[model samples]
Target: MQKEGQKSSKYDFEFKGGKNNSYVFETNYDITYEVKFKPSSYLFDERYQFSSQVFEMVIAVTESKNLDDKIPPDGLIMFTIAEIVTDFFKNRERIIVYICDTADARHLARARKFGLWFEKFKTTQFMKVDASITDEMGVIYMNALILHRENPYFVEIIDAFRKVTGGYSEDK
Candidate 1:
């Protein structure tokens, strides 16, 4: 946000926490993939589909400091991303819960019942959701998965922050 007297500066690259986009997923042997919000937004901000409110997280890792080779190549982006995300959530008690995945039949089946899933993780906290939508060409390339809160604790944090600071990242 621009300050009372300061002007807004342009950013070099735009981030992807925006609204209304489609994606897919695909797999073969001992599968796993991530529904990275590329900056994971508040999971249900879109799922519940409220027009006025876009409760988002600062999911962008492409901050200048992140330009280092820490970004692993494509396909392996998950391991690096998961590490960062896990560590990030650790710092803020505000982020109450997170769900990750490992694709398998039993977990997939459970996801149909529970809503999210992580194969490496025991079926304790997360409910697995299978996102293998194959089309005529082959396996599904884009899967639009939603990571929502069965509990709204994260939302409470967002609301509280808004109440206190009104979305400005820092004081001028």
Candidate 2:
């Protein structure tokens, strides 16, 4: 946890750049995580005629050889994520889409935890919007889009997302 008045980055674990726009970091618990930003503009291109930059942010546990149980809460994990996001926004304007994994049937819980992390660590220059949809199979998918507040196509991007998600509401 960060002390009062301390920057969030101060608590971030050291992370290194990985192949294909991925960031790799290891937690104090010895769990390795890989955060990747995969090109995903195809998701919006055909439907919305959109031509801007968009990536699907995927975070996964890359190596957990020593772990045999569920991972515990680690504040540094959120800090590391925040740092990677900050780095991603430094160069250009882009949209990051995060869809929680539903394989374990805990996607809602994952989404809630992600929401808490974003709410606690997001900077003033950042903005996030969330949406949820139920597929024909009755599986619910929760997703979030994060972007710089100064993005040129901010309004259009949000609109495209809303249209794709069946006009789902935004988060305040």
Candidate 3:
């Protein structure tokens, strides 16, 4: 039970300032994860180009050196991620786009897990919109756009995301 106005996660994390806007944290199993928020405004340029900040959030296992490692479930990981997201929203007008990795064909599962996390930890100040599409090769891509509720370009951002996703709206 996180108190209002308090950070979501009880775990500690550090922001590794670099080209990719990375944040790092370690789990109890000694597994290290790096969460990167990369600029992805180009995805919206074709639809609704705006100055509002947009980024793609990518979470990967580092240090372990093996993407196939069978890591045990760590609830703290979600807390750390929620904490990072809380910090990122300090600007109050940014958007985060998260596309699940499809290398193992578990994109849907990943998206579901992320959606659960967002539903669990998301505050009232934020909103999430989900979209899914199958590419020409029939690869399903699942993504979510998270943004601050008070963002000045809220309508534009949602409209742009809808356009980018071929008029798909989760609300509809």
Best by TM-score: 3
Q: Pairing residues by index, what is the TM-score of model 1?
A: 0.26
Model 3 quality (TM-score): 0.87
Check candidate 3 and list the clashing pairs.
none
Model 1 residue runs over 4 Å out of place are 1-36, 39-47, 50-81, 88-117, 142-150, 153-172
Q: Which ten contiguous residues of candidate 3 have the minimum total lDDT?
A: 1-10
Of candidate 2, the 10-residue stretch with the lowest lDDT total is: 10-19
Cα lDDT of model 2 by residue, 81-114, tens digit: 8888888888557789999999999999999999
Candidate 3: list runs displaced more than 4 Å.
1-9, 46-52, 65-68
User: How many steric overlaps are in each model, in order?
Assistant: 14, 0, 0
lDDT for model 1 comes to 0.30
Largest lDDT belongs to which candidate? 3
lDDT of 3 by residue, 1-172 (tens): 2333545445568899687789987765567788998987787784454543888999998876333678877677887788899898898777899999999999999999998998888677888999987899999899898888898888888888887887654521
- The better-scoring model by lDDT among 2 and 3 is 3
TM-score of every candidate relative to the true structure:
0.26, 0.86, 0.87
